[model samples]
Target: MGLAAKMDAPRIDRGLDDIYVKETSICLVDGDRGRLVYRGFDIRDLAQHSNFEETVFILVHGRLPTREEYDMLRKGLAESRAITPDLVRLLRRMPPDAPPMDVLRTAVSYMSNFDPERDDPTRTANMRKAQRLVAKFPTIVAAHHRIREGKRPLAPNPRLGIAEDFLRMVTGKRPDPLSARIMDVALILHADHSMNASAFAAIVAASTLADLYSAIVAAIATLKGPLHGGANEAALRTMLLVGKPENAERYVLDTLANRGKIFGFGHRVYRTYDPRALILREYARQLSEKRGQEDLFRIAEILQEVTVRELKAKQIYPNVDFYSGLVYHLLGLPMDLFTPIFAVSRVSGWTAHVIEYWDDNRLVRPLDYYVGPRDAVYVPLDQRS
Candidate 1:
């Protein structure tokens, strides 16, 4: 009787099959098939040959920009590097303990207030917004860190590439060329992965006719939760807390015994491996070699090996987070700043998503099942008494 009654109720949870927006993109990922393509070209091809600005142009305009056009975009980026003084003052006023994601979420939303073209979503406007978002997000990130440390924010250097300029602004020194190149490739690799959590959130919000900033703010908020963008920070923290490679197996066992989910091992979408993870594993390894820090490298490698064996036995696999924290570590980012750095590059993809949604949007309203009493009424309290 109980089984029959349970079977009578409708399934309330949807796997949400419609969330992935299939576009005629050159960007493609066949996870189970272990394939990744971008702009009718493979990622490996792009990583070998293309830079971040080139990749960003590809994602935005659906074709590589010509040299003259690329130069114009670069100047537009540099010319727009500095944030308003008003924004700086507000950032300085924020509490030192505020999370960087929160700072970015709030600051980006606040950016709309100053823009005369904020309401325009025509192709021209979106193109401009895309450029502004990609250029300014790093500034916002660096300001949050510097103001909290009671240090002045450094200006973005026009001469530097995106990764080097970002590192220079945040760390107040230029990075080694190899380290910067690795970081740039990581950013390019991470720039898009169709309809992931944050992208979906932004699209759903945009479907409701929200402004670009509103859509982006909601997406950043979604990314702040542990199940999504926060996992990399969790990954870094897990490594730090474990403190040694020999302790990792015991730590995993204890964590599993406590029924705690390991941060970097499992993913929702991928079956065999995350393509981005493979890309970043190289960067992490390269950086460790360059810095002659074999211990850090060995610790990461052991953790990766142990995680792959245990998790595969449990039918799980390493996701982007697993390798990304190691890359960020090698690139000399503070643990706390890992996810904000993710935002710096992902803003390009997010802008692309919002633009796509605005072109052909419907309100993202879905039906819900009502489980309340069919016909219930309230009685006057005094009368009932």
Candidate 2:
């Protein structure tokens, strides 16, 4: 081979950006058109027409549920909503200053100890475990937030749906119907998105035949990374810092000039405006108006326009995080709990991927191109000089 050909022969995909590592039937991320799909259904439809419980059922079971099936799933979620009393005491004892994501990771790990099916990888058992996780994660998060705020965690109200129950638990008051609807859509939007980092992490753990809780713990740890799942928190902070619509342009220009990342404006996958962001942009407006925070929403709008104008040619556009934080803020969620709430939604996707991984499982071991010297002689310590 020519030298040029030799040099090109082993070009490994750095970061595996375009590499298709495995096949999945759970979700499809249409990066080109910025659409997200769950089991052949458009996320926009699911977000508009379905609730979190239904969307999660579709993701895990690979189809929409019949009314009986839907009712069963909802009943399971409702019945399993209470965390163990031991978990509650543990939550109370945890460091109040700990990062919510870290606390969530540890909590999931601890929860596995109480699971009767902790070691069972059977499909039925895994599904049952998934039901418990979906039910308890919001409770865990709200409880943690409550403890840190010097309030006792409230028991979940089984009469309400997950969104309303979580809101009530965290804020000590039931969310209005519209706010609950917004929260439901947010959960559906975040439920799944192909094999994002956290799902990939869960799959890797499952590829090793680890238990479901361990796999999800892996996913939670991965999602704790700022680059992967913390973008919404950072994005909201940016808008908060910018403070007003008129100041957005200067803030973006200065940040870009300094090579600082403007979080929420770009994605590794989507080349077009993110469909979730499109839906949330409107919610942010309406909810902000309701909360008398029109100025805050306007700042986001200005930033969106400025960034889109400057970066659209590069195919860098908003990807879900841009408006989500604003909505969360209007809902009275604390800033630190933002990513944990992401976990609350994404656990459905992570467990779904893990369950699917075992169907035709293989270890996810990839080779790296080594660059260091291959041959070297070791010198005795006495002869080193």
Best by lDDT: 2
Residues 1-385 of candidate 1 have per-residue lDDT tens digits of 3565567776665756444554646357776755677667677777889888888888888788899999988888877878999999889888889989889998998898998887886878878877988888888898778889888998778877787888877877888888788878877887877777788888888887877877888778877877777788788778777877788778777777788887887666567877777887787778878887666667667777776776776667667887788778877788778888888878777878778666677787767765566567789888886
lDDT value for model 2: 0.90
TM-score of each: 0.91, 0.95
Candidate 2 residues 1-385, lDDT tens each? 4565568667788767778867889999888988889999999999879999999899999999999999999998999999888998888888879998998899999999988899987999999999999999999999999999999899998989998899899999999998999998999999988888898889888998989999999999999988888889999999999997899999888887898878898887789999999999999999999999999998998888888887777888988998888899999998888899999999999999888889889999988765555568999999998
Clashing pairs in 2: none
Consecutive 10-residue window with the lowest summed lDDT within model 2: 1-10
Mind sharing the TM-score for model 2? 0.95
